[model samples]
Target chain A: MTASTDPATKEPFERVVQAHGDVVWKVCRGLLPQHDAEDAWSETFLAAMRAWDRFDGDRVRGWLVTIAHRKALDVLRAGARVETREDGPPDRAVEPPGRDLDLWAALARLPAAQRAAVVHHHLAGLPHADVAALTGSTPAAVRKAASDGVRRLRALMTEEPR
Target chain B: MTESTPTEAAMPTVPATPPQRLEALHRRLEAAATGDDAPDVHYRHLDSAVGGLLVAATEQGVVRVAFAREGEDAVLQALADRVGPRVLRTPGRLDAAAAWLEAYLAGRRQPFPLALDTRLARGFRLSVLDRLREVPYGERVTYAQLAASADAPRAVRAVGTACATNPLPIVIPCHRVTRSDGSTGAYLGGAEVKVRLLELERTGRLPD
Candidate 1:
């Protein structure tokens, strides 16, 4: 309920980023690789700033998530040169097991529907119905996919480091 | 499928983004937002003889100048209310205004050599401020005389109000409008600054 998230004072786009940036980053990272996630993050915020005057509702997080979803899809649709296990760790040393790289690697293994549902509904904090609408799936199927995605993530993360 | 904390999802402990990467993105956002003219109000603080001056501007021109006596938070809220909510303490946007104020405080007393947006003042008040600026760098005028100059001779009290609410303060030369009794009547920055400003014009130095 503080000024940062409340929007009671008509929170500026800067506060919007300060409050929701980490979640948006996670959503992007879950859907794409490190490089592509960075691209999507930049695009989402810039687009948000451009249309900021017309944004009246209080669902700032959800609004940003929707934009991030579209931007991530744009990157994938452009060339489908998206994240895969074989993309390997970034040019540096292999990261520790519990880091974002590891979690994203496991997420990369899920089916597209499961990944989208899990990223949007879990990481980005969009409701199940909202994620369903964004991906054009029904709520029940989204729920199942997210549950299945979580179940798979738990197992994959606990496996021996590759 | 829980959405508890918007930024902090509790399920998988997402490691914090590296500080360097996060800082790079923040700089990128600031550049892009300014590139698109998104930060509607850019403000900076300047050290001046009178006090710490909060100078804020928009894409239009210099818009607000406040003394330390007026709380910085209140001044910023006023900007957000009157101007736009995209207020950011971005540096470099206000370097020109800072230079002008610094020069004036150093006893140069030149008219502000930049565009000024006086939209906060309206109607006769705006006229009073307009005439107030023309009173010249070294001269002083009575509020009554200023009211006559603005074509509202009987609205002398209104003239006082205009100077009191002047958004630009020292830059617009509201300190030049004095009481007919030859005393500095009132100033947004208080009377002592009014005296020092006049002395700066007369002796070319602010009193120690």
Candidate 2:
């Protein structure tokens, strides 16, 4: 919820805010609840501004989203640590009331890479080849990740206890 | 084979459900992303070192516009593949944008200098985007005011959607719309841009 300034590359810095800001917000939606999305999003770009010079311009969008993913993962880890310190890890939040909700919960259960692959493919309208490029995996690997993610989600949704 | 129980036999089959709605939403998003890149449309040369080709599109009727930069052929190719491949780089397609944005950056523009193509949207979303465009530069309107302006005051949340799903950000000036309590709501271009745009209009300095 705060803005940071990078002294050396001013406009290019703001331009990053302009260019890939949507991706940051959308990525936040996947990792955090709707209510926390904004907070996580702000943290992502604030971190990005401090690290902007290290970003390769050619792969800027992917770089931004990658950092956002790491930031969000850190938030999730922090939440987990808090839960462990208090009541020994969150269970209710991960398991939900209905099948549809459980599908999203299952998505959250994925290893971050698989989850990101699914998100980058289905929601982001990115092709498998481009997603593979972004994730630094081969296209075949991205396809497998997306398929596995979807398979796990489906299994969670159709489990008999529903 | 054992005789089937009547209750068990009465189960209905689950029909195959098409992913139609999801596909449609994807297409709409892709369309919103690619926009019109016909060379006939005007191209603004941003500071090249910034490293992207930027384009602004306006409704055929008026000239005011929003700016978006999709740099590198790889990303552009990706956008085009999803949205469409027909992109033109016409020189003056963005005349109104250049004028309005220049004035806006210079603290001379208010209430925008053009009309928007809500044709890019439909139904409730179109209504929301249209209302957002009415928001004046330098001044802020609450999401409630935006919904009220559209005559659906109860739909303040929908007003927020209009802002979130805005296809054209700067031109519609969704950044000018905020929470009633003055919190800058979630902005597509990040709250930093929102604050900077506001700061520019207010104190005449784009935040350092």
Candidate 3:
């Protein structure tokens, strides 16, 4: 049978996952802590795979990012009842150590809205409008949060010894 | 903020490198996509006497077997389109089918206990494939004979069509059917593969 004969078929879902995986992870990392980010990332993809048939293949990246945004929010909401350690250098010191600890530590210090704005727009390359929708803010607000987050991140990264 | 100015200049250099955890998370996502904990379609490439074949299976059984010429990516796309998009490259899930194919290609002729998903064919075409399985090993049947066995004697051409489009080719033994004039008809695995499979069954070894 000719490949074009089937209008019902779309590109394979695995390719979508492979292509957008890192971006989804970045979005999750921007919103949640490392462990929770990974969980959200996994949940985003698993949910995507389940709903893949109904998804419009043309906007795969945006759809995936939206799912990731929602999944990350779900993770944050679930953990809201639990008390996290206060945000400070000494408080950050107790986190399980790994490479880029400083980078993640800096990220962890930002207000949640600013962090999401920076991660979604800068790292994930999502439009300010999309980030705004995900974060429940306007595009202009998203831009400001990203700028403020970056300014704070610059301060935080420089304070840490190389 | 002057001390942080240098860091601000470098701030644009947020770790471009993805953390190791992302890769680990991707693997975990793939695992969960194809895990036995869920109902999902699993696929993988297999090397055979013919060439690379993309084999797919669901919880029901072996569903689609596609030759390399058809494109593994295309085959998977079709599966995603036709079947659920829950398909993933899960080699471990195909272990049973692989074992059966390995033994069969090694000239063992072991019957595959795996269930066949015939959703790819329907109506008379589906009946033709079902009839093809009883053709017996080391024996040949004409397209006309296959059609007659399916109780559609006038549909010899339809029988050939069914064989050509058989989703599960080698497993279904469509290679056992030939032209009424004793010529090898078209095969999804190509003519050379058809010849080699017939020779293997006839002489207990592939042709040199």
DockQ-based CAPRI category assigned to the predicted complex of candidate 2: incorrect
Q: Compared with the true structure, what per-residue lDDT tens digits does model 3 show for residues B1-208?
A: 1223232233455454455655677567756765444435678789877788888988788999999998877788778777766677767778888877777877877656778788888999899999988888889999989988999899999999999999898899999999988998788888988999999889877774
- Give the per-residue lDDT digits (tens) of candidate 3, residues A1-162: 344334366566667767888778767766677677778988898888777656654677888888998887788788882312323454256444443566666777788787787777777777789878877899989878877888888788778666
Ranked by TM-score, the better of candidates 1 and 2 is: 1
Question: Clashing pairs in model 1?
Answer: none
What is residue A60's positional error in candidate 2, in angstroms? 28
Model 1 over residues A52-152: C-alpha lDDT tens digits?
Answer: 65577678889999999999989988856645543365622434444556678888888899899889887877788988989999998998888888778
lDDT of 1 by residue, B28-142 (tens): 6666666565677778788887789999888889999999899887887778767776776655678889988888888776735787888888888888888887887789899
Residue-level lDDT of model 2, residues B108-205, one tens digit each, is 66736464444445788888876666666578899998888899989988778877866566667788888888788777656777777788778865
What shift in Å separates residue B121 of candidate 1 from its native position after superposition? 2.3
**Model 2: residue B95 alpha-carbon error in angstroms:** 3.7
lDDT of each: 0.79, 0.54, 0.76
lDDT of 2 at A54: 43
TM-score of candidate 3 against the unseen true structure: 0.82
Error of 3 at B178 (Å): 1.8
